[model samples]
Target: MSEAYTGGCACGAIRYEKAGAPIAALHCQCRQCQQRSGTGHASYVVLDRRDDLIVRGELQTWPVAGDSGNVKHNAFCPICGSSVFVTFEAMPEMIAIHVGSLDDPSCFHPGMVTYAARAQQWDRVGPGLKSFAEMPPG
Candidate 1:
């Protein structure tokens, strides 16, 4: 990686850093993600390992049942209510950082869309990309 990815919540209360290249980056249009983001979709950059992720200050987390039937944990700054990160109950080690929370949003390159079935017909992700009704098999 050229420069290490570093970012924090909108309030700067929670900060994190990641080493190594990202495992996968995607735009999720699932119903659960839409509800969480209050937008058309949620953009996420997934890193398989959680070793280098560092959190500073306090981050409030909420575990929500996802449409995929997985327990999803969402993190944000208690002060700003900014959605920061997400983790899965089954795969506790992986970190899914919100693209909006990144200081450099350019670092995110979404390659696919998840939960395509639930995506609104008018609100589409893009023209071309892999689309899955649910998370593709690992």
Candidate 2:
């Protein structure tokens, strides 16, 4: 069996573990991502099911309208202010965890770049990965 994915907030106030593989991994260059990460982009690993994922500690969430017009709940550690994960109002069963929050961030293998149209020149993504101007259709 594949090893579980584990991670938490920088302050140890929040933690999470997922039992299965990720659904997708990508770097988002949307304006909100840039602002939240204080960088050109944010990396995430999308999980297909939220039911089996175990989480500990309180996460403060802020609601924001996504570029797709859907509401996204951005969850973070209230104490450390470290963004941890995001949940979609439209896709409640799915969850996207920040790659930086992972215990072993090297496990992230980004397959694509989202919001490439908003990507900054200084934060260029690798040329080999597929990129989309906006969120791609599933």
Candidate 3:
């Protein structure tokens, strides 16, 4: 069996534990991602199933439609305002967690960067890994 992954919010108001490694972990530099992350890119941990996730907290969400026109739910801790997990209407079986929200964030290793065409030139993601002008057709 795969090791269970665990993490929590900065204030510990929101804690999460899950089994299975991420199916896809990517850094997105889309305009929406930049604004959300307050940087050039937003990191995400895409897990297999919401059932595999165990979270503790009274979270709040502000749902927004993504460029793909999917309902993207932005969930965060109600107390500390730390962005946590999210579920997109396009991908029902997955829960994407913010890497920064992890108690031990070092586990996050970005495999790719999407929307490089919109990425800020001043804020480079540096070398290595594949980059795409837009989310590459999977």
lDDT (CA) for every model shown?
0.83, 0.92, 0.83
**Shift in Å, residue 94, candidate 1:** 0.8
lDDT of 2 by residue, 5-78 (tens): 89999999999998777788999999999999999999999987788888899989999999778999999999
Tens digit of per-residue lDDT, candidate 1, span 1-138: 634678898778788887657877898888778888998899998887777677788888999987657898899898988898899898887988899998899988888888888888778775698888888888
Q: By TM-score, rank the candidates, best first.
A: 2, 3, 1
Clashing pairs in 3: none
Candidate 2 minimal-lDDT segment of 10 residues: 1-10
| Residue-by-residue lDDT tens digits, candidate 3, 1-138 | 355678877798888898886787788888988888888888888888787688888888899988788898988888888888788888888888888987777888888888889989887884797888898786
- Clash tally for model 1: 0
Clashes of each: 0, 0, 0
Measured on C-alpha atoms, candidate 2 has an lDDT of 0.92
How much is 61 displaced in model 1, in angstroms? 0.4
Candidate 2 displacement at residue 119 in angstroms: 0.5
True lDDT of residue 52, candidate 1: 65
RMSD to native, candidate 1? 1.5
lDDT of 2 at 91: 99
